[model samples]
Target: MKFAQPWGRQRLSFLLEKAASREAQTWRGYVAKKQTSQDADVSPAQRDEAVRWLTELHGRLQLYPETLVLAVSILDRFLAPIKVRPKYLRCIAVACFFLAAKTCEEDECVPSLKELAASSNCGCSPSEILRMERLILDKLDWDLHTATALDFLHIFHAMATASRSGFLDSIGLNRSQHLGLLTRRLYACLADHALMQLRGSVLALALISLELETCCPDWLALTIDLLRKAQMDSSALIRSRELVSRSLSTPRASLPPNTVYIYHPLQLAAPARRPLGTMETPRDQPALPQAAAGEESKAPPPSPKHLAHLQKVPLRCKASTKRKVEQMDVDDFYDGIKRLYNEDATSAVHEGATPGGGAYSGGSSPCPPLQPVGAS
Candidate 1:
């Protein structure tokens, strides 16, 4: 159902009652504490529940781990502040995933709206499905472009694999192992379901770090786990995990998302766990900030002219086999291309005598291949 903006006195009182029922600190005290409490839907068991559902759904849909992680993020985000009844938890979580999929996947060809409603235990019609989509957008403050907690885990994995520590190098670990560790850590964070209490940029990183530390005490072990994921390269970030963690002590920006995120993982601290010669070395190393900045500043977004050129490029053409991939009905240009290319040598012979629009092998004069008799 479409809910009115929660600003009216009735809505405000509803929120107030929600806070009290959940024993959550009043919104008035949030500024002072800066630490979020376990949100109404956030708990050890709840996180596990969300993870299990997403993991299964993602597997069935054949989406990326990051995509599933995005679903988890949406669940955390919408459920973070609201105190929805437990009966509605599945509804809210499923709605968030549906919205997140539309946001991330260029192609939203998964299950139908009814299927999603069934999954969430809601018997909403397509119209209700559409309404919930709007409600979610309003609740999230439209911060859809920002990175999720899963991205941070990826950053950690990259740094861990890039570690030059004798311990890691001797074992000849790869990025796959690093990514594996990262995935485990992500799930394990839910083991305690402490993520809801985590907030902002660096603090969230610290909380995840603590959880990873607990799962496998050894730094090398965590590094090894990240090596196993294989989704991204771990080399670029190997030596910078510690520095990233230290800068995470206080977040400046959100470690940057996507490619820009790679350059400045974080600044280094004084010589400590990683010795200069042993594995952690920074003396002659290139300046990370400059490298990262250079990459980000390389070019501005495409201009209108460029966009026009891109638009001019047809999505598909008959001869253009690559970009011209067809869907549903395949007619028009495809038939023409096939007719023209029927026979390499029959061009002069057949000319415009072709019957059907598409090429025909059973024709009186079949076409020839793209070769002729002569030099090899």
Candidate 2:
């Protein structure tokens, strides 16, 4: 969504100031030490794994991207001052997630503690998470609201859009679509503990800069303008951009190539019903005579019934196949919309359907169907 004009510039300035002031106070990175050390600390790998776990839970729970960002911010902030044991890291992480949800999410939208614990599978009981939450609150001084990288990202993206107006249009994405893509990339950067050393504003700007460079010819000018406004060091941003670029561009592990075996349910359900040695050939069909060792055997021709059945099959594509293909495309479109909006498109479609589980008929509509925005 585009921010309102006039106030948009002022709001951006205000958020930049607030974030700059709070960034140093909130920024925290843990020392990656061996778990077996006498003073055990959260390792980088463990922290990344925990963040990945939270990311997965965030998608599964359908929580807002803001919630996940805030949760990670909280986790880092809490871990910065306090030295948590490696064993209790999961519990702490889960507690921070819960606390961030309570702070950023609506009262009705926040999941119950019991539900969060069970869903996250963080190896912590609800009571244990409650205890950790209390400890975290005490450590953080009950301040859960902090301007995260995501917050800065929103401000920067809005400012960029406001300045250019038609930049995203050229890229074939509306504001929401582009922002959603950047948000996902930011999430990936957050999972890497290496980028945690950089300030939130610098990291956010670096990501935006990298994206702008690919699409906007005047990306350097925009970057310098944002840097001046944010009061960020150019060198730091450059280093961050390099690190973020490398982190983002790093190849993901793919599954090894293997043949996929598909089994039909009906075949598996009654496997024993058909004896292994049994042949289903009709008795009326005579078997081919045994040929000489060097000769090829001739098989019987098809029966009239079989030929008739084969002739009945259409050569062209079936209507059902076309429908299936159309449905697949429709599903892909809705999936993109769901990623953009984080809404349950399936439930929305179900709600839009008729009571008889059919398409809408000629009548007054209860609600209008969702339309794609700025689709190319």
- Number of the top lDDT candidate: 2
Root-mean-square deviation (CA) per prediction: 29.4, 27.0
Stretches of candidate 1 above 4 Å error? 1-48, 108-111, 118-126, 165-173, 199-376
Instruction: Assess the local accuracy of residue 344 in candidate 1 as a C-alpha lDDT between 0 and 100.
Output: 33
Which residue runs of candidate 2 sit more than 4 Å off their true CA positions?
A: 1-7, 29-39, 253-376
lDDT of model 1, residue 122: 50
Lowest summed lDDT over 10 consecutive residues: which window, candidate 1?
26-35
Q: What is the lDDT of residue 218 in candidate 2?
A: 92
Question: What value does the lDDT take at residue 168 in candidate 1?
Answer: 42
lDDT of each: 0.47, 0.75
